[model samples]
Target chain A: MTGTASRPTLEAVAARAGVSRATASRVVNGGDGVREPLVERVRRAVEELGYVPNQAARSLVTRRHDAVAVVIAEPETRVFADPFFALQLRGISKELTAHDSQLVLLLTEGRDDHVRVGRYLAGGHVDGALVFSLHLDDPLPGLIHGAGVPTVFGGRPGWGDGPRDAVPTVYVDCDNRGGARDAVRHLVGLGRTRIAHITGPLDQTSAADRLDGFRDVMVDVDPALIAEGDFTPAGGERAMRELLERRPDVDAVFAANDLSAAGALRVLRERGRRVPDDVAVIGFDDMLPVAEQTDPPLTTVRQDIEEIGRLMARLLLRRLDRAADEGPVGAPSSVVLPTTLVRRASA
Target chain B: MTGTASRPTLEAVAARAGVSRATASRVVNGGDGVREPLVERVRRAVEELGYVPNQAARSLVTRRHDAVAVVIAEPETRVFADPFFALQLRGISKELTAHDSQLVLLLTEGRDDHVRVGRYLAGGHVDGALVFSLHLDDPLPGLIHGAGVPTVFGGRPGWGDGPRDAVPTVYVDCDNRGGARDAVRHLVGLGRTRIAHITGPLDQTSAADRLDGFRDVMVDVDPALIAEGDFTPAGGERAMRELLERRPDVDAVFAANDLSAAGALRVLRERGRRVPDDVAVIGFDDMLPVAEQTDPPLTTVRQDIEEIGRLMARLLLRRLDRAADEGPVGAPSSVVLPTTLVRRASA
Candidate 1:
């Protein structure tokens, strides 16, 4: 036990218990069919010998590794920078652990790795997959479906119609539209009419929904102020600069994400504008670092990313367990978790 | 293909390939010594019939999944909030992908998941594991090694001598001592005589080494100016406030990590102290958001977390391949990557 000596195997336990290897494995793995007397004998042997069943051997019988793949479509740098991914990862890790599953993180940004990921999933290396950060018309969803494996996308895939090809998918989306609208409404409530918008990449559904929410509210008020950004601080800075050059008197801004808002804050500072007093800045996706560390701590929309991860894992696990017996376990359901407006110093 | 369809088994592929099931499995898995003509026939049959071999079946023959687990010991909030984890994850993901290995992320903070993780690794669920954030006397490194698994720790495991067990570990650390010394020396060169040190958690090797480095430099300058923090923003703020109360004449501060430095900055600002002009601040482990978003930005020591991850993965892969030929790999080895002083508005 203290040195590099290998632990006793199932065969040794079986030999000690005077039972067959199959009976020993059955008792160790807690299979239901073993007799009560044999179970006790095997259990005592396992305790005495301190035998841990080889996981590889068990996986061979079960044909299930009890692992799930979490695929992200962003560069490693951006993924780490965004607190949203971490929160979701934590949530997923927690839920997966409850189900005795492991989370395999797959970054599919590079073209070569992306193809390899498709083949890996298709090859049945994982029990299921939970994909995040899907771009519109992304090939992964279809590729996964074509491979006959169960998958649940984090956000709604670009496929407009419900579950394409009968591939069961569970989309856990934040109330991007409502959250963005609420953010803009808060600005309007503050009596700022010349409000501009800094949006994320238009290709992403989150970006589109948020931008649409901003436009929907703005059209009812005034549609003259609109600027697009790529959901980055630099993008926000450039967008804010453009918005200012277009309308110097713009009194408020709604950035689709926190980094962009931080960028807008930088641009505002450079232009000698006071936050909240001169320009009320609001960002979505209440990312932790930017939300708290912003000059005037950013007032933003808080999306419960951890909850999203938990829900996605639960849904995928359900599908993995009952896909054969009960067909798809849940409805091709879309769960939109609520987003609340966290009013901080900036807004 | 449209509805839920059971995946084709090896038996199905064997029937389709006009060969025995064992022969088909060997051909599909690229087993050596197979005749070329039959191999060509098997390959064509696999492609034509859209047959994908289950990884479990393939693993039985090849005993390789080409996957490794990278375990982080922090909670989800901390994992995401700290840019260091993200950078390292990205680096490991990139390197593993290059080696055609999958990266599995295992978070061991949740106590309930501990058993599942232990079983997963011990069961040969992964080829090897790379673990991060080990406190002194932490049981995980020993437990993993005890299970006859190959593992690597992200940083020094706080047991000053090195890993106590014969587990072959590759530790990727930053120049904590040099970075801390340089930060203190920079403050000294700035003509700030009364410099106070804010240290990170004493248990972590980085924190301990940094504290040692700071003390060494301070002894050369003045050993009287020293305090301790937990590498957290609140901790830094508390430490800074205590230092201020203890010595109001303290002109400069050196924080062990960036979060604590950010905390220090907040406290200094609340007390109406101007950065650099009044009390200059320096931080280590230059995490992106905190450093960038802090007012006037932060001057800190930059550790390449991505490189650390990449190196760790490469080392683990090498260890895994080497162990395949030899018995278990030998004692743990450490790799200390270089860190640079990033000058910004803080110091």
Candidate 2:
């Protein structure tokens, strides 16, 4: 009470309310069994003194920071390149808000950030983590596992044959392979034979899964029909150009995502190929606005991105609760939500 | 040491290292002024026991959370619509990470979140807050200000005739009015007399400022020459259509931002109008990929959005340091960074 003249301490509030420090503490921390009159007096005293409870101190006894960290391994530009992460973040935020937990967002751009993130998680600053480890060779999954924090991954991580692989990971991901299969089948239903594919960066599991789906359908297709893209409009444009040059007779194209699809559409327009008439096109991840705003719109695979985010948070929160209620029980199983093909003007 | 059987306490580490609890505490909490051999022994013991420091306990004595909350007033979708906020976040992350501060991101989508954010900020969970109160009528500014936590804003808030206006708010904003002026003046230099302006939602200060900038150059033009937008591509398309119907002779358009500009371009293209010959277009906030991806590319007013974020962090950290050294000095003044015109094929 006497430490900082301008700031009121718990002692001051207790003295003003004519109660013991213990009674004041109970009253301030929710007043479970405190008498109503005493609680009211303490509340009034707190209001008059403008007392703010120190969260860190309360968290020490409760062993709950009430905060969850969402670790995005990509740089900010990549995170914002499309609306995928944004929608996911919103879903995660909504759920965390419902649970009365704060979201500690960690965006790791490079190797240095990896060390920082690993250290932060191991330091026990947050209760649990929702990590987006998109890349197959990403070191984050291994580092995070080593940190020994309860975590739920955003996408299905590529678990290599290491000691880390033995640790079961709870993750929330869309059915990328199935979605790609649905897209390719739709193009096949359109009576298009010479179909080409533009894939997102192979390092990412989503892109790799999509590629596998494409191959599952086009088992004997020419290898020249495939082009590598980085899930950006620029990459889409380059890939589209290469595909057109390699097989000018190609009647349809399947792009990994909407941004690249938009770029491919632009190339088709430049080359005077009518959409769905001369060259039908389909894309994955209907990252709206881009999917909707592209000239003639886009026919693509749609994943409930927000739901994935929410599920990730729910899984992590459940794990945290399980850990708290009965030490650590068996980990929750991972989730794989379905994806549906959205028909539009393009395909 | 004996509270939780599985979790190792600081006492366990001290006992394992054969040192006094005080000596072990000194070593574990940085090893300042501790003997090198003793520090090594304590570190080895900590590693062997997997002892993680109790952050809450340490924070109670140090009075530092080593964390900052980034309060984004917008919902996740809008934040992700363009890369504007993403770049700003990256800039902030870069600076905060450099200073060893964790980022606690709080995304407020509705009214309930306002209360949650206010409570979290006032609870002394984090050292400070960087808030983005984009809308003029937003209640967030008032609630956050009432919390009495140190805060810095992302844009100029619409502070009406309230007692809140008396409190000087520190913020970081690009020169919206000035950037708009440059955009319109660029059109004027191109000899376009029938130039129309697409205003962003007037509820936002950035949009309002840009409209003022248009008026600053256009002077007394037809009121029909201006169209309202919500900074989305759909909004832009709607506004562009409205403008084309209102003034068919319009030869140029200056959209408040790039998404809107892209929409306007789409509309113009659909109407079979040749760009730059029949109509030229310009946009603000060259939000990278969008500005670059637009057909004919876009001439734009470029503001260092990332730098704005970095500068905001720098200002808040400076204030925090000043407050720590002496009681609060004069508040740091708000900053308005200059914007420059970027010429592309569109204009």
The DockQ values of the predictions, listed in order, are 0.22, 0.16
lDDT string, candidate 1, B227-305, tens digits: 7788788899899998998888889999998999999999999999999899999998888777999986999998887
What is the per-residue lDDT of model 2 for residues B290-333, given as tens digits with 9 covering 90 to 100?
A: 89999989999999989988988888888778777786666688
lDDT for A165 in candidate 2 is 36
Instruction: List clash counts for every candidate, in order.
Output: 1, 0
**How many Å off is the CA of A10 in candidate 2?**
12
TM-score of 2: 0.72
By lDDT, who's the top model here? 2
> Looking at candidate 2, what is the lDDT of residue B229?
96
Worst 10 residues of 1 chain B by lDDT: B160-169
Chain A TM-scores, one per candidate?
A: 0.85, 0.89
Q: Tens digits of per-residue lDDT for model 2 on A274-303?
A: 998999999988887789998879999999
Query: What C-alpha lDDT does candidate 1 achieve relative to the native structure?
Result: 0.77
Specify the CAPRI tier of model 2: incorrect
